[model samples]
Target: MVDILEKLTIVVKRGKADKNSPYPPDLKGQDGADELTAEALKMGFTPDEVLQKALVKGMHLIGEDFSAGRAFVPEMLMAAKAMKAAMKHIEPFFKSGSVKQKGTVIMGTVQGDLHDIGKNLVAMMIEGAGWKVVDLGSDTSFEKFLAALEEYPDAIVGMSALLTTTMVNMKGITEKIKEVSPKTIVMVGGAPLSQDFCTQIGADFYSPDPQGATEYLDALVKSA
Candidate 1:
């Protein structure tokens, strides 16, 4: 049973979606995350257990590698794909209340920014870390973010901006969120953003990498 779970983790980390997936070369023809996840469930592992012990563990490894420069965007995207394949099997459990999420994260690429690669990566990382992510997609406005907040009152907000021009919008978004929900946490990220800029914008946190964002949210859940 443990071996099955371990295989699931390896497939995810190696970016294998299923037996049909030939990604990463070496693992071709072997069952990937999709199959392994189902196998774990069939072997009587609870959804929560499989999530924490296998899926999340694999994503954590990939996240760390990404942060260390050992992994690149392509690898991270592949890993996220594998994780997504596995997640499909467990999502029903989450909706049925058999598994609980750590928190809700409302994410978007701030208005005037059409970039979504960075935003998507962070959303995947956060979702793998056990949080429910509601992605607002690119070119998101302040009103869209606020609407999401109103729906999920306790949710955290994550904003991304790949362009220096669009990054300025984060300041206004953060201010508006605070106006409505001062206690809500707002995290900002993207290439043009710095810790200094984050502070200036009044955002609660800033991380250069997806792993840092995941860790920050995890700490928040633990502290709460």
Candidate 2:
């Protein structure tokens, strides 16, 4: 398990998707996330083991680097792709109830905001952290959020808005979510958002980047 865990983690962190993936110059032609994950499963490693020990660990390391400025968007995106490749092998187990996730997260770009770059980054980060992500996509309205919340009652909400003009809608959306689900936690982020704005809008948290959101959610899981 230790050997497989480390191998899978390295391939995923290096953004190597499969035997044929050539993105990483050094690891070219080697088994990647796809092949390594499949092999691990065949060897009897549990889905949760692959997720928590490999996929989540690899993504967390990359997220930390991105947060520290040691890595940039391209690195984050690549690592996410590798993580997704590994996920394809384990998703069936999660769906079949063989393993339980850390939690559920509902992500969306606020209404009137069409930008999704930041939202997508955060969703990928959170999903890689081992939580189930339900993305509502860009221009998501309060009603849409409400519908999702109805389906996942205990889900944490994450909202995004990259445009200053459209950001005000976050306040309304947060209010509506709180009105019906007072216990639900709400996190907000984007280029134009700040911790002060998060407080003003009644959101529980705010982050400038995907790594921050990932850490926040991971901490919540630990404290639970």
Candidate 3:
């Protein structure tokens, strides 16, 4: 059982989607995250166990590697793909309340920024870490974010912008969210954002990578 769980973690970390996936070269032909996750379920492992012990653990390692510059965007994307493949089996359990999500994250690329790659990466990583992600996609306006916040009152909001000009819009959106919900946590990211800019905009946090955001959300959930 432990061996199966470990294999699941390795496949996820190495970005192997299934038996047919040839990614990472060395792990070729091995049963990947998709197959191992299903097998773990058939072996009587609860969805929560498979998630926490396998998927989350694997993502954490990848996150650490990313933070340390040991991994790049391509590797992260592949891992996310593998994680997504595995998540297909666990989502039903989430719907049935057998697997509890840590929290909800409302994410998007700020208005005027049509880039989605970074936002999507963050969304996938956060979702893989057990939080429910509400992705609003690119070129999202403050009104759309506000509407989403209204729907998921307790959700944390994340804004991204790849352009320096578009990044300015985050200040307006952050201010508006704070105006309506004083307690809401707002996180900002993307190539043009800095910790100073985040603080200047009154946003709660700024991370250069998806893992930092995921860790912050995890800490928030535990404390809640």
TM-score of each: 0.99, 0.96, 0.97
Please state every model's RMSD to the true fold in angstroms. Answer: 0.7, 1.2, 0.9
* Residue 125, model 3, lDDT: 88
Q: Supply candidate 2's per-residue lDDT for 71.
A: 82
lDDT of each: 0.94, 0.91, 0.93
User: Residue 105: error of model 3 in Å?
Assistant: 0.2
Candidate 3 wrongly placed segments (more than 4 Å): none
- Comparing 1 and 2 on TM-score, the stronger one: 1
Clashing residue pairs found in predicted model 2: none
| Predicted structure with the largest TM-score when compared to the true one | 1
Which regions of candidate 1 are displaced past 4 Å?
Answer: none
C-alpha displacement of 130 in model 2, angstroms? 0.6
Model 1 lDDT tens row, 82-180: 999999999999989999999899999999999999999999999989999999999999999999998999999999999999999999989988998
**Model 2 — which ten-residue stretch has the worst lDDT?**
71-80
lDDT at 86, model 1: 98
Q: Report the poorest 10 consecutive residues by lDDT, candidate 1.
A: 1-10
Clashes of each: 0, 0, 0
